[model samples]
Target: MTDDLLTRVDNGVGIATLNRPKALNSLNQPMVDALGEVLAGWASDDEIRAVVLDGAGERGLCAGGDVVAIRESALRDGVAAAKFWFDEYRLNAAIGGYPKPYVSLMDGIVMGGGVGVGAHGNVRVVTDTTKMAMPEVGIGFIPDVGGTYLLSRAPGGLGLHAGLTGSVFTGADAIALGFADHYVPHQRLTDFTAEIVAADVHTALSRYAVTPPASALAAAREWIDECYAAGSVTEIIAALRGHDAPGAQQAADVIETRSPIALSVTLEAVRRAAGLGSLAEVLVQEYRVSCASLRSHDLVEGIRAQLVDKDRNPKWSPATLAEVTPDAVSAYFAPADPDLTF
Candidate 1:
């Protein structure tokens, strides 16, 4: 009902359009809660045969959570910031586990939270405009919102590479990496929308206006898999640094740019998430880690340096990757005594 999100029914389909175009549809608490409510309602509505999720503008589907809000929350009440992430993660799980046929019009910038919404769908439509990434490490957070599950399902060490490096993938690369199901021309969105409204999705999707060739991400598969398999983020960084390949060095740059603590915790979460039984299980485990992350050394510092001050010079605790301790890392997985139920 809020302008942040709009919902309506046309024929047998329920449509949810993200309306915050200026922020590239970045999710705030209101948007997250609203989306969760609408999705939950549609899940039980027998008249709603399917759902179409899209953003209002041409820029992208969604960027991710509003980190500026997170930064402000961190500045005000530290524990409340943790609660925000917890609630958002639960909403992500609800969308992923929704029983209805959720179709995502994954155009524009589909990263982090965007992927959480689109990737879980029964049908995911990707366009040339779609630029997909986890990129959570770049912002000093782990890729939550079922991202750990998608990363786990990625080919070989690609999950680790993409998760750690926060690299962007083109539509073709997205499909090859199993992040997207179909690709279509960016200009044909109107036709695509029309088909979904007509409730003849299968037939409408069969025709494509344009298709691009494979992307560079696919070509670097062997190197990504071999290099990313190292024991730790530091080890992975060393491995990439040691390689003579230019691509390895480039990958190393990304790893080096990220918050050492965020990278460390994210790798651990992804590894742990890979071992879980289902999407819900992965999210629950991630919730435990994230709750603890609020009190961890790097999160607030990371947010301060990146979003609040806009300096990008985060004074990460432990200072260097080598100084990160196992016990410190273990704290991220420990249950918060009050325990977050989601």
Candidate 2:
């Protein structure tokens, strides 16, 4: 529908390609709307048996959401930013609930909103070059886009470690952590997509899927579970610091650099999302936290430091984890106005 997203129907397969290669196919409101519209149309179309989603360009599938744009909107008019999240979350829900098989080729960088689109699909195909993360805390935000649901369900305490440190995941690591379903070689991806268009999705994917390399996350799971399973962020950090392993100490240091409030609230969100049964429910909870985060000084400051200023120095309110109060974290979970419902 828009140049940012190219859509077409090839035989019984509907293909959607993210076209903003220069931006690493980072999503904006227009791209989100076009994707939602195309998916909705194909959902009921008898001719379309399945859909394939991928990004154009050498870099990756998508970098993330248009954070610079969201930051600008948040500063000028909070309503615009809120609406963007509303629509984006709805699209995420649609992808999760789509009736037809949905194939997402996460060939490169898949983070934030990109993860929402690719990971939530029925068939998530990651390649050797694939690098995935939910690095929201670094930007003064919690992982949204139904990230809580996905991460919360990860094996052991791996999800908590991921959320806290914003660790990047390789294709093997993604599969090990349950974020991706299949691993296809990057060179074979185009051919694989063609096969899907010509034949069946499951059959084509199975034909191309290969066993990934040993996951680094799997090797570190014992330490991760031990460090992140603590009841609170302070305790988690203390555990990480007290751990004998170098990796655990490094992880502890990484968490120290992120926004304290974001880290605190994100921990609560992931823990709570673990109990939730549905993606829709997780989206609602995410919405509440996101809306509350908009009013926090850290969100805007985080965006400014990371994207705007590029100084990489964010002055977080409640500068230390201990400064983040229980009440302040609880407020992020309070119900949003006109609550997010399917």
Tell me, by TM-score, which candidate is best: 2
The true-structure Cα RMSD of candidate 1 reads: 1.8
Model 2 misplaced regions, further than 4 Å:
none
Cα deviation of 166, candidate 2, in Å: 0.9
Report, for every candidate in turn, its global Cα lDDT versus the true structure: 0.82, 0.92
For model 1, residues 271-338, the per-residue Cα lDDT tens digits are: 88888888888877777776666665566777677767889887777777888788877878887555
Using all chains and alpha carbons, the TM-scores for the candidates as numbered come to 0.94, 0.98
Residue 5 in model 2: lDDT: 97
Leading candidate by lDDT: 2
The alpha-carbon deviation from the true structure for residue 295 of candidate 1, after best TM-score superposition, in angstroms, is 1.6
lDDT of 1 at 289: 73
